[model samples]
Target: MIGQGCLEQDDLSSSINIMECPNVISINMSASTSPISVSWEEPTAMTTDGKRIAIFNQSHSPGTSFPVNSNTIVTYVFDDISVCSFNIVINVKQVISSPDACECEPNFTFLNCPLNITSDQPAFCGTVPVNWTEPTVIDGCGGSSSVEKTHEPGSEFPAGVTTVTYTFTDSFGNQSICEFDVIVPVVAVEDDSVPPVVSNCPAHIYEVLEPSQTSLIITWDPPTARDDSGLPVSLHQTHSPGDQFTAGGYELVQYTFTDAAGNEAVCEFAVTVYPNGVNIDTQPPTVPPTVYCPAVSYTPPIITVYVENEATSADYNFTWPTGATDNDGVTPTVIASHQEGIQSFPIGFHRTAIFYYDTSGNRKDCYQNILVRRQGSAPTPATVINCPQNVYLEIPEGTSTRVCWEEPVVTDDAGNPIAATLWQRRLHSGAEFFINGNCNEQFVGNTFYDYYGNVIRCGFSVTIRAIGHENLPGQWTQWYNRDRPGGNCDCDTTPSTACSNGEEPIDVQCETLAGDDWLTVGLIPSAPEKRGQVAYCCPRIGFYCWNRWNALYGQQCLDYRVRFKCPLQ
Candidate 1:
């Protein structure tokens, strides 16, 4: 056995045929020893004698042949020498496992469809492990394929794309159906649709004094809706912020804005207007002066004139000096008047005055000043001219009273004693000293006044006593009063006679003077047994001594108002 390496022992090898089909046979030998001596032929045709080997169909050649060089040996001999030849057979028909095809990968798209059928295709075939077989609609000829077939072999489609048509039946009856398109690539159906957000922005403030008509200003900037990350907004009206206002008046007013997505901006401000009516001038004119009547027996002088109207909106009208004729318009009897004044007026004094115009215009006026002596005629003696007649009294409060008389010999209207015209102190209290008065002891004493307010002397008696260094020498009173108001000689009904000795004397009548009355001094502590200088403590004039001096003179105690060291327990 060489070239094709063929050897058959007991004639059972190549192309398998053993003893008339009862055994095997295979032989091919040729190493080239002798031309006719390398042979072997043993098919003498004996079917059942020794063991059966009659398999000779001419030369036995059906299909396989390839055995040339390399010592090709081709010899086959098997007359009737078969023992156990091969033979076995068992055939069945339907066997199929090869027609597989399900392609649904051509780009499908379906996220929220009519219902649902999944097939997203993204598993690239490693060697065919894909299957789906629940699609059986091949009824009659293939007409019920509206898409409801799925064979479940790795089926996962929920994105849209399907084409699986597999119909197979192999093992000889032979049948096949195939289509591949299980591809799915559209996985973006997670839409939420959201887009909008903008809160608040737009305003204006104004105040510029005065004058205005139209000052361009109206604003906005807030809108951007559709929010889901803490969203709560909804508005749609072209997102307003533009109507158009150009430039008007009074300087300082600016604006420009937009929102709702157009986004724009600008801002500025100021506007004012103010000022109105005021005018005034008050009339005043009229002057006449010149008169010397030193002889109607010599004495008479009185004249006054005034007119006015200034305004703060009192609106005015006033006229004076009527119808004149001194040069003789012939009706020359000029007379005019006006009145109204009193805001306690006394700055230039004028209570309305213009006294005199006659010629038939008749007149008789007087707004102040007029006195022409000689009516009952008789009064010419009041010459105590210089000063100091006698007056010094102080008992205004416990322990203080002085009056040292005898210094009133000052005279000059030709009575001779005018030593340098001295002394002046006037006291008249009843308006509770409404202002300047701190000469202590309410000092309304030390008197004298004469420059037409004649008093020439009413104080000069000197003698006051009440001394208590630290506390308690306070209480004394005397010099209550005597009689020295005297008679006042006159001049022209006294015309206030220049205060004629401080006037207050009408028809004459006088009385009273018996040890003067006002003397009170006290220091009592539960009556230390009638403590010192005891001047009748619990008696003399009952009512409890006038109610203990009426609680020690508290209620204006007889109009004296005196309190001396009386404040203690």
Candidate 2:
């Protein structure tokens, strides 16, 4: 054999000792390449069993790197002329996976929180599908995939109120939850024919703007609508509260509300703003408030004067304005064609025209119709008393008597004499009347005065009579008086008038129509009040002789009130 040919088994063909390999070795790879050392037991050959080999050789020794895919190790041994060699296999540990650290922190905030959503139910009653934006969350330690949510986007939801909750956890197991509602109506609404009811709708709004202001900011409660059906409603307006309004004629603001069933209701109002020193007097004035006469009695021609500077309290309800006002902060000049208190207005209607004028000659005309009414009650008829009864006088023979009495007095309920005018209206305020059928010598019944006129009757009576004296004997004497009362009395002294049926004449004899029977005994020249006038056939009838007296200046007698002397029957 040559010097390196000792590994060849040509001479040791007969002693064939198999070369054994070391068991497969395994080593893990590290950050750096670290070698692993391997060893193997030498096999015995025909030459000296386990004796030391004359030549030992190995492909890799200790301190040799054995990495993955590189695990072969061979060893060769030769004892004298016999030798054996084998290979060793090594396995390096591979990294299948790596463990991460635990993270838990409650100190996390949500970048976005979901808001409550409202949606109408489907026309056909059923569950409705709803969608919402996902909430954004920020946590230093975690983000599993997205955020933890109870319901996903575009999820089916039953009608009625439903709460959706979102939960979050941090590295240290700290958990927090954010929730919102997914409201959906369970019952579908019917087709609505009626409109929504609007409330708090404003009337025409009027405001005065300052001279320096170009626009006025008007604030009012927004109109609200209630759906006839129990469903939600939406409102849209042309203007909102606190919006600016310029001065023109009328700036109309309209509001529309729509219900779930596609029914709509509208509310509209005008905002009229006028600049200073300008007036918007368009309509006619209404009827003024009713006024009453304060007099206790019915008095005609009441005069009421309205003071120019007097300010009446204007707590009226949109009727005729109590007084005029100016937007320029000045008392306006008032021009009224109708007189308030000066004119004698009956308890009825009176028309008035009012004009409001500024210093700049800007005028606004208005008309008001006033009404007058009576107040209190009318006084009752006046009370009259102290009327004399029927008078009877028995004067001595051939004498007259004076008839005098207290007049009737008038008084009120309080015993106080009422005004003369009041007495005139009810009591006998006119002249006293004496009613006799014809012109004759007689004292009529009494004094009678009508109430305010002769037409109405109201009076007391006064009567006077005389007694005749007996001249000789067999003459029971009594005075007979027929003052303007016609027919014949037989001069018989009786309390009542005794009329002689046709069998008696007037007074002298109850036989013929001519003689002393019709001749009256005495005459009262003046008012028949003087006593001791000439009686007992002394002269003639001093008043209206009427061809019966036959003497000088007898026919010149005026009206006569005669009483005759008669014999007691």
Candidate 3:
């Protein structure tokens, strides 16, 4: 038996085959109250004799085994003795927790929401009240009583644009906002009122000579009126005030008044200018018996004068005949129908008639005859036969010089002697005088007064003439020098020698004499000095003397040295 056992052992040992150990196995099971059943296929092995398989825990502890189809712990090791080992493992997967299902939908909505409103209304002169509708909000959760809104309904809004906001909030805090605009447009308004009330029309009557007759000044107070809207009233007239109307009968005028509302009212009045019965006297007065003459200096014989009647019943007016002269210097008078005061006639034979007129335009005239003898030959101009030479006299201030000179002989064309009636002298100082047939007269000495001082020289000339004789008019003789002898001449009585070449030289000299104390100083070489005098000088040499040396003597004298000598007075 031992030998047979040994041969089997050698055959098992030589036939021993190590199979691949089964991989680690896992078993899955749900979490439960009971233990899990673990299961795995066992690994096969080859040996000379029958092999045995055993299972143990990983610690190799004895008695730690697991049944193939029993509920137990799966972590175990299986081994074929002297061949290979296998492992088994169990994995537990618990059930996954899931969230609870939700089915809630929260939202917001706008309920009875106000829409944009546009309004067109007439413009109010004053402030206008505003109105609007409020917006309501509806939430999907419930009612929208908790919604917030801005600009409440029926609130006053200005005439322009306005905005309204509505905000809705749901129970879940979701929000919905709605907005709209309200516009109030402006519109024009019309006004209709009655026309203005006009009154105060006038009726005028005027006479011929009045301004209303010629330029008919048709004037009346401006019409007074009222307007419903308190607007100003405008007035217009067919003819303005101060407008002239022609001489005529009755006339009509109109005035129109208007108000701001375009209403008008008109008023009418009448004007009249009376016709003038008195006619204008257009016919001029009549004159008869005109005269003629060949010479301008011949005297004529005077004749009686009278006026003839030409008007019947009208009042009469008579005027003396113009252009009539008398050699005796007597003025003629004209009465109702007679003329008197006839003595001598003018050189020319002038026959003039009296002019007569009546209120009714009738006229008549009277006649006069004046016959003048015509001379056979023309008269000759007067000649200066024995005129004195230019004389120089130094009359003192407040003194005078006897202006002595030989009278010039004069004759007519017929060799008849002519009488000298008048003599004229024009001084270098622009003073002129007419001496009545006197060649020897007292010449009062004077001084030139100017703006600067008293420094002027003067000279004069003399001429003769036959008065009332046109043919015997005298000619101017040579000029003579006027000297202030011994500085003696009555300064107060002497005329001023202020010379000017302009109008009325003598008058200007007299006017400048004011405030002059007979010794008012003046500029040297005055206007008279510039005009070349013959040794002439101012008589007085005092505090106001311009040139110290007297031009008459060519020597200077002190105030004490100057003497006053009256030669002619």
Candidate 4:
């Protein structure tokens, strides 16, 4: 209005009469619903041409209440808007309308993310093995995704606890993880049981009747052992120190048997024998009778008896009479005695005085009669009693002394027979020393003058005059010296040499020792005195054998008898 009409600058010239048009309509885009199409109805009569006109403008805030662009207007076809936002204003003769509204919500779709894992698996016991399966995506979501698998206890899972994991990835690059468990089991086993046994003995073992028959030999084979079935067992043999069972002669022996299970048993055996029959006898050994003189009253000597293994069961005994005489009228006498059991006669001389034997086989005996004789009554002087050379005293001057002859023996020269006067005497020393006093058989001192006191010497001669009248008296015989005088003391005075101290060198040291030294030395170098003698009688008499003696003296003289009688010479 101000530009098209002629304008005059006048204030208030009737207010120019201009009425304001009504507000224009608008198309709005709501923030809650974006990317939408906006539309509105047209405004009224503001452009008088009466032609329908459409004007679009971006809205600037026309009022203080709404936010819009002031100078923008947009025009487009019905389908021209896409993904855009705006507040639009319309002017068509003052009215405009918004297009059909269209809104696009944010494009929406979900993507699934499965899980996956990677780790080692578990192990098993002993030699047991294991199986494993990888984890898989069991659950799924909206969008497509990839799943990856792995084992917790890797490759080999033992007979024990184990686990596996699965991981999934979505197209949106999201991921998830899951797991499962696995289990395993195992087991074991074994065996044992048994016993032992034995077998039969050997046939070689048996009894025997031999020299060593009292004992029996035994032999055997080793035994066998087995399980409850039958296996060989062990055997061992043992014996005692004196055990006779071994090949040698021992008293006892032992053997051992053992089983496979180490058990044991023992066995043993023995032997013995007895004795048999026998006999024995005993008798006195027989002794013989003996005679002394054959020409005179003769008699047999007595005898003795003996035995072995006899009825006495030992050396036999003889019950002899104390005064037993021989068949020859001779007295019996004991010589010697002894005892024998086994080798009685065989071991020594047979018992000449008896007989003997025992339960066993044994025996012995002897011979019988012997001869003896008696002396004659009358006897001639057989010998001169004193020495032919007379003896003298140490004194001289011819001291008076008696000279006499004795007839101690009264037997005949041959010891067989004699006359009534069996003894006689002779006077030879009477001429040397005169007889002063005389006894019936012996004369006293002889009378002689003594001129000097020194030793003297003398001798005399004698003759035998046989005076037997009967019994074949022998012719007169000359006298012979019987005994000589002189030596008296003759004995051994010696000692033994033995030392009690066990000392050495006995000859010197032992003799020099005190105490019994002298006696010991005497015994060391001297020998005992031994003496013996013999006697003979008439050969006509059975007693011609010699009668010996250890020592014979004047005190032990004896007489003999002649065998036949003879007239006086």
Candidate 5:
């Protein structure tokens, strides 16, 4: 067992040097009514170099009696650092006495029984080998030297739930069995490598909206698809023909065709909508990379560049990104703080900020930093001023991809450039490549090299994450009407007063009575909703702001619009 990165092994002669406390213990009693007395010797913690380490948090003594029916977990700490845990189980023994003579004990138990396993079907799709640690069994009175099981470890299990049963039989043929389920999803088994082909995808288009109309209806011939498997394919679209397109520029329409085997292909087109009466050049032209942050959501990202040779400067080409399309046609103008070209960079720190503008005059900007380092310049360790912002991608788990990003920039005392070195992977870092999961803070070691080959070490933390499957959008339900203007606003909000709508005392059910979702009501910001007031307004969607004339001290009420955020469509 390992805690964080420290290993806790049980073997006395193990090569790991540091041996933890007792392993899992299972004691069986021969008599049914007698409780078993269990005992174990505490092991000494040792270092790899034949040194001794002090242990702390030693809660249990050398031995004790097992509880009648409850389970007892034992824990040990090594050097007040690593944690080790094991379970102690006592089996209830049932003696089968016979007139003929020797009889077998009917009690048979396993140590740390494996739990049910749930796993997605492997890419192989066929029967795959499923394995688990075969549990050790304890036999008290019967000499059960051998064991039998219906399905052994490493046995191939078909897709779906398969029960693996293990049986233990004693010398006198008394038997006991334990079973666990292994489930593999069946949908993923129907796999295909070939994606369907989409035809008649529309090209980019430009249009002028009618002077009187606020929007335009766009239409196109539906794209067709074919699968190499000669099977029908399902088509999903972001927008369909005759969908209303507002005056927003560069609206995207996409359709995806998926074959029966789960392979998919997409067809996409963009349409630029221009407002009324204009010259022949009214159609928007190809604009420069239109960035979408710094103004709206933009924060210039700091980029770090390392100079390889011990020189005053180095020549490096910058990488440009594909900016997002703007609602209004993007302007052709692109601004940069520093002139960009393949030029020599001096041994110092330099920053560049790029600004992008749309036709609407909304500005977005990004930032980059150039750090040129030389041998004789002062050496500085890496500092995380701005790490690369992470994004979610619709990529499958366990998939590997080559990723490149800007490294954070740092400077020395003289304000000269310095770059971090890829020193070493931590013991708990990713194996081979990063897997699909949420971002987590991981410590990384960095080593800096001076002109004389001396090393300067520094440690810092960074979050690493992977893109997950495509997320589905949430849908909201239309507001429901139960309460109206005549309803008692104060009584509705107050727990003591059963809200009366003048007709009868009935509290407004916030979806719970038919429940599942939370029902909300609108609130007029001007009028504060609070107690001590005669009647506060409780306005909600599908219902009007209501106030009971004499409800609660005659407090004034405000209007609000509330709706339910739907969990189900």
Candidate 6:
């Protein structure tokens, strides 16, 4: 076997060595109700032969440990070969644990903290109700029940701002506080009273011409009414003063005046109308003397005379002699001879009489003498011949035609050509146009127009007459019918040289002037059952140049198209 010294040299050198001391330990801890554990690194040493070794506390285990308030010593020993060993004294210390801080701040939620109330408790005539808001507190530690309020929440207070405080203590005994305010105000009331007054009420009377008059107008001074409250008072009328009333009697008219307060007053009057009486007349009239004169020429002279009734009443009618004048101012109820026109009279002392009658049927007569003597031989009469009979002609559409005839052959009883004033010719349809000539003369009728521009024909007539020495018109002739060709008479379809170029060919359509197409062309078909295109040429002269050509042609073509006749050339 080997000696003990030799065995130690082999094992001790590899297992043990002088150890190093651990660093002073320091610990910080929080004061908590639960248990806390602590730990550290063990001391270590190295052998002379380059081997590492561990050291452990001889008095304590390396597992669980507790912190202390003061510094404490722990001894650690390192053994090598069980004969050579060393101790490491570690100084472990503890820092006092700090109590937990209450980090939560107190907060209060006032439902309606800033509240308003009236001093009258219930303002607006008790229309407003009492009101307030409750206060709530919140804390971080969840101990809201520990909160205290200086005043009870939702409690009514006097009219003014009132401050309240809320305090909260958390589980850690940390305290916080919050404050809020409530407010109240004052208000006043309003009053309304008083009524209106009426004034200027008066009465009146009205009279009408006849009792048979049903519509009577009664006017008066309009009354005045006012309200004391400065408000406008409305004036109402059941019956207006100037309204209609019953006939043949007197009636009381009433007017009522009212104020805004429903107060009313009335005034009234009477309306009277008299009855109409029967009217009659029984008077005779006096007649003036008649002036006499000799028959001078074939033309009769005019005579004027006056008559009056002794009673000064114009209530009679009169009958005058032939060729005597009658005044337009004479009425059936009044008789008075004012003036007269005597167209013709015989060549002798002729007695003419005038009779008169009153409205009562009484009658009287007055007589006068007119001495008419022959002046000279009467002038000879005139004669006419060769007046136009009938004429027929064709005029272009929208054009006028002239009708002329050879002068008629005329002569007097002396076989000489009649003077220019002795003869006349007349053309008549619904009206008359006259041509005068004493000697041989020519006549032309007024220009006639075919306004419709149609191709139809129409007729008219003319006549001739002669004047006698007595200025009497005599020659009467039968109507002569003249035929006139209507519009289409001058229409030509061939295009003119000016119409060949320069302007593009517009699509030609056979349509009414109203733009209603009734014809067809190629793919573009018009309304059913119509004709082909109508060629129209626009006259671009003067005023016609500025006008739209299509519109002008359309209007003109409509008439012709409707008549189944093309107006375009």
Best-performing candidate as measured by lDDT: 5
Worst 10 residues of 6 by lDDT: 541-550
**Could you tell me the TM-score of candidate 3?**
0.16
CA error at residue 529 for candidate 4, angstroms: 18
TM-score of each: 0.14, 0.26, 0.16, 0.13, 0.25, 0.14
Residue 119 displacement in candidate 5 (angstroms): 12
Better of 1 and 6 by lDDT: 6
Residue-wise lDDT of candidate 1 within 1-569, one digit each (tens)? 11122223453333234332222223223222211222223333333333223231122222323221111112233421222222111112223355663222111111111111223232221112344444322222222223323344565543223445444332232222233344332211122112222334332222222234333433445333222211122222221343223332222333333222232232322232212121111111222333221112112223222223321111123333342233212343322235323222211212233434332222223232222122231123224432222222323334322222223343545575432222322221110111111111222222222222223323211222223212433232221222122221100111222222443222211112332122222223345332111111100110001222122123111211211121122
Model 3, 1-569: lDDT tens per residue? 10110011233335544444445443444444343444444433344354422221122222333322111111222221132333333323333344843222333333345444544442222223446655454444464335677776666554334566665554444344455666442221133224555656554434354533453455556445543222334554555456566654335565766654466666655455444663343332333334322222222335322212321112122234554333323333222333444444323223444534332222243554433322232244332333233343333333322234333334444545543222122221211122332211222232221111112222222222223222222332222212322343212222222112211111101012223321121212344232121222222211122222234334332222111211121
Candidate 5 at residue 537, lDDT? 19
Which candidate comes out best when scored by TM-score?
2
| Model 5: per-residue Cα lDDT at residue 438 | 26
Poorest lDDT segment (10 consecutive residues) of candidate 3: 502-511
lDDT winner, 1 or 5: 5
By TM-score, rank the candidates, best first: 2, 5, 3, 6, 1, 4
Model 6 alpha-carbon drift over 4 Å, by segment: 1-196, 211-214, 248-250, 274-569
Q: lDDT of all predictions, in order shown?
A: 0.25, 0.41, 0.34, 0.25, 0.46, 0.32
Clashes of each: 67, 18, 28, 122, 18, 17
Tell me the lDDT of candidate 6: 0.32
- Write candidate 6's Cα lDDT for 1-569 as tens digits: 10111112245445454443344444433333222344555555565666444331133344434332212233343432222211111212222234853343322222222212223341211122344465344433365446677667446554233456555444544433334444332112111112234456654343444545545566667566543222233333434545565435345444554433354444444454434443322233333334222212212223322213221112112244333322322332322243354334322222444444333233344454333332332255543344333332323333322234443444555667632221112321111122232111112222111111111111112222223211322331121111111232212222222233433211222233354433222012433232222222112210011111122222221232211111223
lDDT per residue as tens, model 2, 116-187: 565665412345688887765565445542347778878887544466767654443444445566756323
For residues 232-347, write the lDDT of model 4, one tens digit per residue. 22333343223233222122223444433344443332222111121111222223333212222212223212223212112323332233333323343332233223322221
Question: What is the C-alpha local distance difference test score of candidate 4?
Answer: 0.25
Question: Clash number for model 5?
Answer: 18
- Put the candidates in lDDT order, highest first: 5, 2, 3, 6, 1, 4
Compare candidates 3 and 6 on lDDT and give the better one: 3
